[model samples]
Target: MVQADACDGDADRMTIREAIREGLREEMQRDEYVMLYGQDERDGESFEVTAGLHDEFGDRRVRNTPISEAAQVGAAVGAAATGLRPVVELSFSDFIGVCFDQIMNQVGKTRYMFGGESEVPLVLRATEGGTLGAAAQHSGTVHTLVSHLPGIKVVAPATPAASKGLIKESVRSDDPVMFFENKAIYGERGEVRTGDRTVPLGEASVERAGDDVTVVATQRLFGEAMAVADDLAGTAELEVIDPRSLYPLDAETILDSVAKTGRLVVADESPMSYGFHAEVMARVIEDGFFSLDAPPQRVGVADTPVPFAPDLEAEVLPSAPDVERAVHRVL
Candidate 1:
């Protein structure tokens, strides 16, 4: 029996928490096979993203597992292969290391190794990024490394609206998807279209338009890029694009934007060394190097562990000014 009601089919503003709750609730109601579990998912999740889901779906559907990352992933994979859709939350992206074996060898390569006999239609949601005083061990934007793995789709949504839509789509997809929620902007509010809303994976959304420089950002930095571009409106026309899905990258959109703009800048929260910004920079170089007027620029976190102090953390992480500087460099 369906416990939680579906979306009301009306557009309304909501926090990221409310939006994600609606998405998980809607998906659970739409498919009886869909189940959600994590550390504290049943008793108001640590981040409160899945708050109250247990009450609506009951204990059998919303479970809280032991703090065993490998066990959680292995169980989710087994359940998915047996005709069940399980959404597992790893709490934080940094904890991905605990289940790397399962994710890399078992879940990631199951379908290919089995000759397409089984599908791991599991959605793993994890809180990502620093800036909340969550120091080194607790914070990470690990999508850069995770995206390198085959058979796993990486998704990072910018706003509440995109969060609701993309998460709903991720739950319904027939492949394993790693969904990262930026922990810093969880309380930010936005308009979310109700009733079966979805933003397809691998599509890039141009947040702002310009003719001189293109700024492509991921995760929470996507909005920061938009704001920085707005600040530079009078000086230079800046176009901001959010490539929501990192793995099946929207290369065409970014390439076209670079072609028209003649310059590119990537702003990401990850470190500069082999980071998410490096991935975007490499893409532009490989496909549209000839279109560039100046050297491509990247704004990313410093190569160091995130500090607990706010001031020290600010020094390492990329900010609006850093993005502005990078944009100026390519211009």
Candidate 2:
């Protein structure tokens, strides 16, 4: 679902990792107050997503932090409150629980509690979702958890272009943003707009246009839905929508699509019960109830932990076939 002409002639083909690094570099150059710090960030660690960043920005702006989630996030909150824009990398979204108190209480409530006098312009970056066989502990899509909190903005970019634009937008925002990068799509290549182009935080991307059904997906599932739409092309026209920003979700685009197709299939990697799919389904039913031609279907992981075993994990995780079936059910 990578856009062929994302920025017209002002675009380049880059992996999601490179696009993110480029975005970070641009932001750092654009604003002197913007800084990035986290575990092994100076060395770029295993993924090397921030490999050249430390070399360019040096130790002051890209220093490594101790292995403490609470401290990393708490420090980010403090840094943001004092006028610096800090982007803290948490390594894995699964480890967010260790610092949930800091995120839920401090990062989420500082502005409101201070009567809008204080601004925590922080960005919490983490790699999330499965498909690498990293097992349950390292591969959980927990954006839904952060989205439940009141003040934080949740973003899950599906393509390299989005990865670049959303990161820049998240860094510049005057509010705390939880930016979740799907671990599986870092190497995926796409055309990324150059210059100061930034995708707004609350807008959705219509990856594919169709007439029969609308498939709303997030993160990795967005690509999966696109593939299904391609395979089922001509047989069933499927409209694919990627809700790039999960919170401040572009529900209007989704409602409009549902109104056109009269069918919905929300596909996400999170658990099904009380998860993102449920939230989207609830919104559709609440606001676009009469537009439904059939009961909306949700495709997601089973109500359980992501299994360590490859086979069990495959069984629990929703796949392209699951999305296709859901689309067919509504059709």
Candidate 3:
């Protein structure tokens, strides 16, 4: 984890929503070309993350778009290709299918198809994950699907600090970037640096350092694993890492931790079948195979769709106890 002293006492306590808004406000102030648009963003009705942005930036740069996801993404692609840096939100990550063609074909492939002469400086922001009774349609963690695409970058920030920093970096990136914010953590609070502080993409934050086992998690699971680490402090020392950028994964940090611990356990809110957990385990085994004392374990939701019922959702989702059990299994 980044220490408070690193900020030189220029940090303020803010929720994930406020942190992201602050980052967007700072970037828009720094670059005149940075513009934000999405459903209900102008009125700050959609998740309230873009609240007050429209008031500050005016309609030109922070206008609301129509309900059509395809039109919003398609327009953002065209705008980016011309000159503007557009940050378009899709309301929910599950709605990605509505504009997958535009994202995969146009946003992800425009630069390569244009012989590297053109740039798509676009950021697609979406709220993801379950546990809010949003059901399967509105509560899917689809970063794994987007990460599979070649040309786009995937980022999932777990904390307020990371959310602010990653948003700034995504707007500044020349390539198309997919920013997946966990809907459940929108109101979670943490201390974020007040000034211009950006956490680079493709980097992992080691929230807790230990030597017995390594536990890699993302989004909500990152916080769960941290709590599990604290509960098992003396019993089993687990090194917890948050892979902020899923596509350009910080495999080196995970590999080094595994090399030291000789055991691995990956936890994610996504399904277990061919998902982020599998990718992390694959990378560790392929690169750090000899550093294993036991078979690595994975903790995630079942292969079924997320249920709307709270009881069923709790049963399907991976919890802190699940992470603790996985650590015990690896040990």
Query: Candidate 3, residues 1-331: lDDT per residue as tens digits?
Result: 3322244577899999999889999999999999998988898757888888888989899978889999999999999999999999899898999999998999899999999899999999999899999898988888999999989999999999999999999999999999999989898898897778899999888878899999998999999999999999899898888888998999999999999999999999998999999999999889999999999999998999899999998999888999999998887
Off by over 4 Å in 1: 1-10
Between prediction 1 and prediction 3, the one with superior lDDT is: 3
TM-score of each: 0.95, 0.97, 0.97
Clashes of 1: 0
Q: lDDT tens digits, residues 76-149, model 1?
A: 99999999999999998899999999999887899999999999999998888988888888877788877889
Whole-model lDDT, model 2: 0.91
Q: Over the stretch 1-331, how does candidate 2's per-residue lDDT look in tens digits? A: 2222335767799999999999999999999999987999998855788888999999899979999999999999999999999999899899999999999999999999999999999999999888778888998999999999999999999999889999999999999999999888899898987789898999998888889999998888888999999999989999899889999998999999999999999999998988999999999999999999999999998878888889888898888999999988987
Residue pairs with backbone atoms closer than 3 Å in model 1 (clashes): none
The Cα error of candidate 2 at residue 90, in Å, is: 0.1
Instruction: Give me the runs in candidate 2 sitting further than 4 Å from their true place.
Output: 1-7
Alpha-carbon RMSD to native, per candidate = 4.5, 1.7, 1.4
